[model samples]
Target: MILTAPVSMFAMLMTYSSNGSSSRPWVTPLVLFSLPLLFASLALRRAIPALKRSPQGSGDRSAAAVALCLGGLVYALALGPALDNVGVL
Candidate 1:
């Protein structure tokens, strides 16, 4: 929970930052799409633990699951534009 939130925001910011002209345009998007898929993976990490600890249908588990799914979806959706910005796609 603590770790995933900041990383999610950072990934989106990096994705958004790629729209601007930089000396090395690939850097931001590259960070956003780093190996091991840290951004979305962290959200999954948070969700898994919450799922184990919280009871089924509880608000905490539900919120964590929703956060993970939505975060992954947003990241997946952003990838095309971010890649296209650097001509990688």
Candidate 2:
């Protein structure tokens, strides 16, 4: 989970083509990839007593936080507006 976040982030970053015609934006990919890490980290924390307060969960927690924030921004600025326009919000 921790590893996937970076890979996904890099993958998304690479899409920002010089011609401004990237296949996908970084925000969506970052959030989508980070969510699973977050869940896995939480689950690991619960499953292992020491992981709750140890560094083991740090990566996942941080990634999750980042993803959530970016995802929220994207939803609010892009998805939400589009949905609202169609009366789906």
TM-score, each model?
A: 0.47, 0.29
Q: What TM-score does structure 1 among the candidates reach? A: 0.47
Most accurate candidate by TM-score: 1
**Model 2 regions lying over 4 Å from their true place:** 1-57, 87-89
lDDT of 2 by residue, 25-63 (tens): 545445554655456556444545533444645775565
What overall lDDT goes with each candidate model?
0.68, 0.54
Q: What is the alpha-carbon lDDT of model 2 when measured against the actual structure?
A: 0.54
lDDT of 1 by residue, 1-89 (tens): 34445665565565555565545554455554564356567888788899889998799999998978877886776577677767888
Instruction: Flag clash pairs in model 2.
Output: none
